[model samples]
Target: MTDENNKIRVLLVDDHPLVLDGIRSRLEDDPEIAIVGEAGNGEEALQIATQRKPDIVLMDINMPVLNGIEAAEKFAELLPDIRLLMLTMHDSREYITKVLKAGAKGYILKDVSSSEMLIAIKAVYQGKTYYSSGVTDILVNESSKKEVPLTDREKTILQLLAEGNSNKHVARELDISVRTVETHRRNIKRKLEVKTSAGLVKYAIENGIVEL
Candidate 1:
């Protein structure tokens, strides 16, 4: 049923052993996918991925040692050819955007059917991005937004905020006055139509405003 030469080698990374086991069992039924390795945390995942060089990795968002986003960033830097797919229970836009920015090629909810999972794996392995139906609304809403350009300074300041830096801290780090940082923050909020700092951070992370 599977073309051995065309098979996609997959690595599963989740802190929960039961979830990993379920995913492995479901995917094992498909001849086109081969479970090459498994890891319980992001650090272990990095080690396993480096050793196995899997064609695709199914990464979970929340882990103990290292989060999925961090691991994805490292993997992208170290193994650019390896496709990363986020497999998580969270359907939040903030989480989705973070993973995408970290270099994940696909995002699928844990409740996805076995068939859908297989298709997503195949799609990401072929270099196409995929999102589950549950989170498709977020993508659609984001796509409908009108583009608003930002200045270089504003962009830099926004990136710092996205990385969880406070306004005062960002000002100090950027060698600018606190008033200047506040001004830039207001300008960024106006441009993005985001009323709060949290909203701005979410937008920045989702849009890949700052390199992880």
Candidate 2:
């Protein structure tokens, strides 16, 4: 009963076949969604995504040969237009931060109901970000404690640093000079009240800024 013109093309990427089947079955009930393809691993997922170019990809965290984090990073580079919605069982801050930094538009737990999944997909497709209710408290608490709020650019720099990217690399990627990167690094450390790079990374990982 789906309308061909209105349906949102989707691609499923998870290592577990049963997980793919369950998600496909749940989504097929919606008239606005269409499962265009599926992949059991990140490599296969990348292939399907490149060929089918789905509007959304429901990615899982743990997978063989290029986990969801790596796949998402590549996908963002190759298919900038395709939005990624992470659908995984893990809600750990490390997993959440890593995937988001990899360019995912949303994150939702596997325990999410069918309706919630649909809402997440629609929100990401519309260029908005979504996070499950259980994880919202972590974000809220972190946001509220900021005596020194970071700018978007600052956050980007911090995220890159937490990913273990070198200052030179961060500068090149962000189109800033090494001196500037260092300055931002220092400012970020001071603002977060952290003394070392390890401390910064730890905070970022715990706060969902970087993956585990």
Candidate 3:
């Protein structure tokens, strides 16, 4: 849908300068794509996006100040027609699911070939979804498993535990008894099939319930 004067505008967001350079180099010469702007973090991304209002945003998941998932939520609210395409190193089901829920239209790995990356960009710009092989594999694998849903309380406790909060700290924050927190923790372990606190923390981080 590129006329001689009109092209698809894209904003690139990533914490690393080298990664931004690589993406810029890949898409700079394209006839139908315009490199409108770039941001090093999600907070900067929001500012640039609000000012530039690009048609698509290629963003990384992990960034300082603000994560891409949270930024994607704001982007959805600020720019309804803007397409959010995730370009990240994370290939877990949790990250993908969270990004999609946060209003991302596509997810692709950072290691993909330039051709595949371009294809993903074009697809998402054209109102379609795209996912890298690694992302699709994680989704398929998770779908094949017997997924266990966590309750709201368990999720809260898990997030607190992952953030290095003690039982007493969690109890105080939630206004619940320490014994109740312990019970939730035990139940979380049993439901998640994790034996130790470390395992619980790892699970929580990997599943997008909490960040490292």
Candidate 4:
């Protein structure tokens, strides 16, 4: 009763029953956190959140009935007081961008240690923005590259390169010839003022084009 009032109420959202179970196992015993409710999809999350009115919602990025991003928007609209923290396997810069722009207070990878998860939840519950270490690195890299001028094709080739994809792979993926890939690489290097492949990779990361 009094203890429940003292704890941070959390609503768990995920599609897989096993995942919800796993999260429950990790968080159920924490004195600082209370598992107020569980929802299998975004719509369910909203319904439960309305009823439960949790302090923070720990949500997954992917789900069948409604994706986490869309649900995040809804949460912003209908439950503006409830903070959102995303737990997911995706570490893509694109996903991070969308989720942050959609109003998630924090984003942590699914593989983080339980302690880290608790840290994220409490941080958001306290009104601070939290991001997984990898996501943080991506964001830091982006700010440095914000001044770099890159074309769409050039950025695509650089991304594949940073991923350690050989020119052949980039060629096939882009449906362009290997020679064309080489040409684009040369152009990117020239534009970025880099002299080597290692330099290209460094620039790619600095430009926020690489996925963590």
Candidate 5:
């Protein structure tokens, strides 16, 4: 649990051992932050997260088993209380937008200074979102762009619901809370403007949101 005292619990996830070592060396001395665990990929990160329950996950983009954005989607479903912060080398607007939509609460480039990193960690730990200066500019520019109707995760849940899977079944398959599944169902309904299970099926079939 991130609750082992009042210190902020953090998990460091990156494929490069050097990167992990660097972050560990830097943050390990901070009394306010506890490095709960480390993972080399998204799958391992998820496993460790279940065991450690970090309050914030500092993740990278590229990984072997599962990428960070996809993992962020899963984290959004499974651990809605935890915050995600992407610290990667990717600075393109496209990457930034995708990670934000994937449920990252903050994005900071790898080149960020250690001081700023500390500030960002503290900020998100306190329930405030943080983005590095360059990322802030990208966010401002992307603020007006409209996103697609449903995220990949939402479409997956929609497919399950349309396939006659109950919320409990969907939650079990997705490894998420039933309440989280219900929240997604409500959002899928509102986004697709459908009020019934039949309506969801029809929309899924018509829009090809599901393979059927």
Candidate 6:
């Protein structure tokens, strides 16, 4: 716990300057939460986290030098005590699943209300997991029965596809051949009963693989 005078320190990590300003503005009013530092990318976030040891880290997912999921895994290994809350426009199942597996304490969309964002931050700081309404709905949907039980690899491909990744991009990320990626894509479509990429994306959204 923070000292009586010391508020819960928070580190904001995002690539957009406007977003950083907006989030800082929304959070600065709360006396209980202190905006300790700001970082533009995951690398910077990790550096600031190491130096500041803030109570909560508001992290963005897609970044230039290092993506949020990769950095989050590193942070989990390096700073096990720190709390990480994803604050990004992306609400994909792959994004959520990877980050949570990397040890994030909460997942919230960038569009969330300031009130809900604050609640998520507080919950994570208190060592509890919190997900925004849309994210929670995804988790619930994932737990229920499904017609197509996708393999782990197929789900990964579907997630990348839903995130707007091309076959080449997915292959590179997973360190697989383009031919292998195409094969998996075909298999995924066949199993899910979706023919087009657009249809796959729609299925991903409707079935909680990605958020609309």
Clashes of each: 0, 1, 0, 0, 0, 0
- lDDT agreement with native, every candidate: 0.81, 0.81, 0.82, 0.84, 0.82, 0.81
Can you write out model 4's per-residue Cα lDDT over 1-212, one digit (the tens) per residue? Answer: 34888899999999999999999999988888899999999999999999989999999999988999999989888898899999999988788877876778788999999999999998878765667787778666555546668888888898887665779989999999999999999888888876655456555655678754
TM agreement with the true structure for every prediction: 0.68, 0.69, 0.66, 0.68, 0.66, 0.66
Positional deviation of 113 in candidate 2, in angstroms?
0.6
Q: Per-residue CA lDDT of candidate 5, range 39-82, in tens? A: 99999999999998999999999999999989998998898778
lDDT of 1 by residue, 15-46 (tens): 99999899999999787888889999889988
Task: Return the top candidate by lDDT.
Answer: 4
Give the range of the ten consecutive residues with the poorest summed lDDT in model 6. Answer: 197-206
The 10-residue segment of model 4 with minimum total lDDT is 196-205
Q: Each candidate: RMSD to true structure?
A: 11.0, 8.4, 12.7, 14.5, 11.1, 12.1
Residue 190 of model 2 has an lDDT of 86
Off by over 4 Å in 1: 1-5, 142-144, 148-212
Task: Give lDDT: candidate 3, residue 204.
Answer: 61
Task: Give the clashing pairs for model 4.
Answer: none
Q: How do the residues 1-212 of candidate 6 rate in per-residue lDDT, one tens digit apiece?
A: 24524788999999999999999998988878899899999999989889988999999999889888888888887997888899999877777776766777778999999999999898778765667999867765765445557988888888887665778988999999999999999998788776555456545655667653
lDDT of 3 by residue, 46-75 (tens): 899889889999999999999899998888
Error of 4 at 168 (Å): 56
Regions of model 2 farther than 4 Å from truth: 1-5, 142-144, 149-212
Model 5 is weakest, by summed lDDT over 10 consecutive residues, at: 139-148
